[model samples]
Target: MTAAPDARSALRAATTPDHERVDAAFGAFDLTTREGYAAFLLGQAHAFLPIEAAIVAADPRDLLPDWPARRRGERLREDLSALGFPAPPTGDWAPFRHRADILGAIYVLEGSRLGGRMLARSVPADLPRSFIDTSDSVRWRYLIEVLDKLLVTDDQHTLAIDAARRAFALFEAGALRQKRTKAFG
Candidate 1:
């Protein structure tokens, strides 16, 4: 018999489609240009601010002690302001009702940090990059460890996977909305 997948592996496998869609949507931006980069940040702020607020409302400190430091909304806002744009209006998100749900959302947010590092290289050096440039591999490792320990049941796994998919969908929708608006153009 095959050994069961770990929480991280399971979540990753279940959400790969959603992840790909979000990546494709956001990847359309030309980060090398200031307008493209600002639009990217605006879309990110639109989705992330509300999602982060919902996560905070769930009070996941017990699961993620360093949650405060992990937040990037303020950094995104700062970057937007530097580009002469105000913060985009936040949208509503369904509340995270369980620890597993919160874990799933955190998975998406932290996972994006990994991609952000790569995208950061594409961003012009003259632009503010506090949101994407911040690196914390150690925190990521800690989150993985937490997931392995806390997510031990089928129900827990399902909740996490569903939450993760929702998180990805939010980002995907946000990117499409910003792309259509051409708000920064």
Candidate 2:
């Protein structure tokens, strides 16, 4: 058999920029200003609520074309506020690093439960009972249960969460760099 394409090639092929495709994805979802209220509720449930929205938000960069990192963070915050969550005095969500995983968990949970399937195991039992309150989405409830069952060690979990967090950071940096290059050129 021929050798398989490497990870870089696979990623490049998978992530090829297609504005139409991106637009279509967003179009599939009906986003209203009211979504902010949903986001606020999510935020009140979990300090890390923004992470889940960030994960699924339509073309986050499209939502905020300039000053990506800051704007992206702000949009998430706005969502939280709309959902009725009290903005923290510090307005910092990074203190809670579990956000992305929580997002991922919700994704899987929603997919499995609504679709009538399951994946990535269940949530662990030892995590605080408070974790389940993070969202009104039934998906979020299922995610809390799944998150509680993750088998990865704490170190591995930390690394995974860090990597996911860095993905957003790198995305912001790349967007900024692209803008600067266009401006200077």
TM-score list, all predictions: 0.96, 0.24
Give one digit per residue, the lDDT tens place, for model 2 in 16-108: 343223223222221223342232223222323344344434332332232122222344355445445544433223322343343332332
Q: Which candidate number has the best TM-score?
A: 1
Candidate 1 residue runs with Cα over 4 Å from true position:
183-185
Candidate 2 matches the true fold with a TM-score of 0.24
For each of the candidates, give the backbone clash count.
0, 17
Candidate 1 lDDT for residue 128: 97
Instruction: Give the Å shift of residue 65 in candidate 1.
Output: 0.9
Per-residue lDDT for 146 in model 2? 40
Whole-model lDDT, model 2: 0.33
